[model samples]
Target: MPTVPRLACLLLVAVVAGCAGTDTSAPSASNEAETEYDAATVENMREGTYNDAFESSYEPLPATPTLIQDATIMTAAGEPLENGDLLMRGREVDTLGTDLPVPNGAQVVNGSGMYVTPGLIDSHSHLGVSATPQVGPHYDNNEVGMATPGLWMEHGVWPQGPGFARALAGGTTTALLLSGSGDLIEGRGFTAKLIPARTPQSMKFPDAPGTLKMACGENPKGGSGFPTTRMGTANGLRSTFLDAQDYRERWDAWLADPTGAPPERDLGMETLAQVLRGDMLVQVHCYRADDMTTIMEIAQEFAFDIRSFHHAVEAYKIRDRLAEADISASMWSNWWGFKMEAFDGIPENVPLVHAAGARAIVHSDDDLEIQRLHHEAAKALRAGREAGLDISRNEALRWITANPAWALGIQDRVGTLEPGKNADVVLWTGDPFSVYTKAQRVWMDGALVYDRTDPDRQPRSDFELGGPRQH
Candidate 1:
């Protein structure tokens, strides 16, 4: 027989010992002991301390009250304002309007003829985990196993990746770093603020919901042995969820009566159980429309909601269904024909989804693409206009800003220029939809993180210190 893991063995022993205790009907201290034990167990389950070992250690930088005057402001929440002033009072937007009085001792910026908008947010990225220079050891975004829900994107995030600086330069202040779609259930993804730091945890978005990175269709089916076909993929997912349900039931039983001993902790099942409990968001990499519909069916079967579908090339075909389910689509602007499933992709996919009353976002799965997400959104906007769709510059900007933040479950904090939201603002050289425009200045939590005019403000990874290299 195979040897049991140490924790499992210990739990088995505890169960046997607890079962050997004498039964007592009297309402004595024994009943109180049981009640206290049950309460502790329930607390443990609710707090989810088992997964807290990788909690975020991020702390916002010291805020400086600053004011930008006479600039066009695209709030991403409404229409654009002309010659507006934005005040950032210590890590949050204080006010935004015309000719706002500068506070005492506030740093002032003359934003004449410039544009201000919320920092761009990428719904799908593999920056830190994949790393720059593209070497074997740096490719930690995927694992070999087919079912490895125990892995987390944060553990593999290399904080020194040069791509992070490039993304920041492009006004990408927040991003969702996801695991590669090489497995049926790859792992958990993480939301992070683009703050330069020594550790990944220091850059994590505080209190953001955990995201499970799942894959369907060609990617997971091609290499993984068991899930060789579409039907097999569905079956595999169903079976895994079924096992997770059983695991959750066992733990619930043990928690109801702690004297009977606790169930052995299974990390993979624990992650899935969080999904079942609606504590974690599910982001799947799906391509075809049929496959996406099937995945929705599976989600219904498992009684969980899919937050968004990454690289959903055919999402336009099922936009109504997605809207009804309240599922968002994180898609590329114009990529297609590289694979069989992506053959039916259209340039107007984003606008079509938006027209259907669904949340549509433009995402970058490639490192180079992440830096120009605004340009990608622009391309989709133009495509929509050419197709006779009524798309505006402000609405198109939401494809990169507010929409992605909603998909990542961080819209309440960093997606808009609201007074109570974080001061993740970017000043642009011109119209952000134009190719000639660039991010002149970028701020995160009211701190000047990047300035195009000052070389000192630009952060470079330690790896880029010795020689000139391409990021």
Candidate 2:
């Protein structure tokens, strides 16, 4: 395996080469010097205007206008519709309503006794990085350093992972692949679409804001190190942010005038600076309520927002605080008591958060659970109803759809079945919350990526070919 520095150099080369189209030859001595000077100038540019060298190269698959008539639709943004008609025209939802006329040259599917919904989105996952048939070398979910924020999950993502196809078969259209919580500040996580591709860049979600995965509590405090205690954990995070602030200040001053020598670039601080500047979302892995409050206080001190807390088992205890802070709770339905910090988890955690007007999302942090996230949401809904909460099926559906999309900062593009949004639709054989139902057809950007009725349309990873579980 290549070292982190070597990987960064290769990524830079690829980005520069791709941007400067048709430049296949090496530059001469004078041209190389000029290129270095220009690179320095680009680096010192304004904060928000600085282009991401690793921007997504994803393009939706070609699709035609498709119409699914007479289905129960869960828009995830409003009440469920009965006998609704939805039309997908060229990667966008054209219309949705009762008895809508199908356009010319559109393929129509009879949806009698079926259900439709916006494709499920998992706010937390480790599919591509921690590839299936788990083994030592394939475990790319965590780095050796405890505070390596410079590392990006996209670098470790293997697009040929079989988990992508499993997720798509279970109706997951979009997912945020995160680093494990073994460290204080693990790395930058990335959002990806469940598209079978040869490279991670081809599966990246276009323009989705980057995510920084941080952690608190026992996971980070396990080893005998600097952050063996809760206080040490807090201090470590605070010190890192302070250092990033200084780095940002120095860069800003250098950008004011590019004539002089430029400051040395630190990859880790650059990522932290983006978080401080609100360009990237912060997703922390926190369990206990007190730890969650402490992290929120730290965020307040730094003036950076916490987007969501993963495995937030005790979030219900501070739902009001989370609501006020506008932090989302991405939690499991019934996972608890596996560790000391998770001992206080309750089945009604999501419901309590939702009742308090906080953003509540049902997330799957496990590889197998990610494929059945809809079922997890269904379990949470049942628990809430049994506890006397009047949560409807449509509202419960949002736990795995709109709520997770908002947490991933991609709600504007692919969360609801609204006109002009990406047509990421799932046709279910029955009510989505029902255990017996399966995703009959899954579409990403209006393209039919998975169809249970067609063996050829079902995607299979390269690893699965000629294996015992071949599709």
Candidate 3:
């Protein structure tokens, strides 16, 4: 699992606590004045505890530490393990072998004849801001500018949006919150923990590297009175990336020698520099296979990675190249015929990608469909079988879990029920692949964030006044 630096973690905690009330700024290098808060005055504030051995000893055993035993573990690798035991502690997998010693404080959850995999991760979603479109203040997705790579998508995220809750109920734990496709260089996309909290800060993952959300083709060009050709879209993206390259060089020079006043910081340039430095990932929304190749070739020219191609309906045509490039394809199970460009899409798209040994993901771009991504994967699996392509049920499960996690650059942290990883797990009532299977419990960071068995545990947005009823 990727580890966030200690300093970054401390800064994040301080930023979150500052939301309560305070200056929130850290002490400076020159004038380090100590500020104190009176404990007696703050009666509700609890004492803080420090554990030097948190990683080794401070295993966060769940309030009801459930031990799931004798299950068909779809490790999302190659084969399923028969009769496996997964020891979940706090928000991570404490143990995942056979016939191990169950801890004293653990509650056993009988998992005989059940399937276990990681919670699904959606690589592409416009759920929260596009949730039925009530009004302006309620909608904060997709900035209108042509180039806004520096902007953070989380700032515009509506924490209480119904989509977040619905996705969780559907078995998604981690999601990449993205800006809508309004510009060629759409702003940043950040990974978020799908849990209900009072603030967005409470839900943002601590160390998930921010990614730049870029697009090609019709969405960016010819919206009203602009570049109506494919050349325009390609050129626009090229110009932005080239500028980003220059911006990175300037920042590096400034960082090397602080001789003069630093150049005024541009949020877009700062984010682009992260991409140039290979710190941030890139998620491009392109439909045609040719466009995918074009953007990827440009990425090679710029010397950065194209993490995943979102909505690549024609990806099956270029599955060999995608595998060679080591890029994942996030596509709908069989969604096609919506537009002329996407008319060539086929049900075999995912299966072809899988057959070519490339990452195939089934993502829900729609708010309603996102809740059943597992079923979507199953549909694709059947489609592949009908096409005479052999795809295992365990590998099909990766369409949502391991594949999407790998796409968003977070597979190591929460992708599988691997030991020494975050306990972000989901327990299904029956076979997860079956249509009747539903996520009974969803745990994030070892906390029972979503429990279908509990009425009050489900998340309800404050803005869901006249919205549709949720499960």
Best by lDDT: 1
- Candidate rank order under TM-score: 1, 2, 3
Roughly what TM-score does model 2 have, to 2 decimal places? 0.89
The digit string of per-residue lDDT tens for model 3 on 94-156 reads 888788678888878777867677788888887666654547767777667667776667667
Give the range where candidate 3 is weakest over 10 consecutive residues by summed lDDT. 46-55
Candidate 3 root-mean-square deviation in Å: 12.7
**Candidate lDDT values, in order:** 0.89, 0.89, 0.77
In the range 352-375, model 2's lDDT, one tens digit per residue, is: 899899999999998888888888
lDDT tens digits, residue span 1-471, model 1: 566665565567646653233342344654454433546546656435544566689988777899999999999999998999999997999899998988998999999999999999999999988889789989988897667888889999999899999999998999999989888899889899988889999999999998999999998889838878988888888999999999877876766566633677888898898898888999999999999999999999989999999999999999999999999999999999899999999999999999898999999998998888889999999999999999888889999999999999889998889999999999999888889999999999999999999999999998788867678
Q: Is candidate 2 or 3 superior in lDDT? A: 2
lDDT of 1: 0.89
C-alpha RMSD between model 2 and the true structure: 9.7
**RMSD, each candidate, Å?**
6.1, 9.7, 12.7
| Candidate 3 wrongly placed segments (more than 4 Å) | 1-64, 132-137, 464-471
Select the stronger candidate by TM-score from 1 and 2: 1
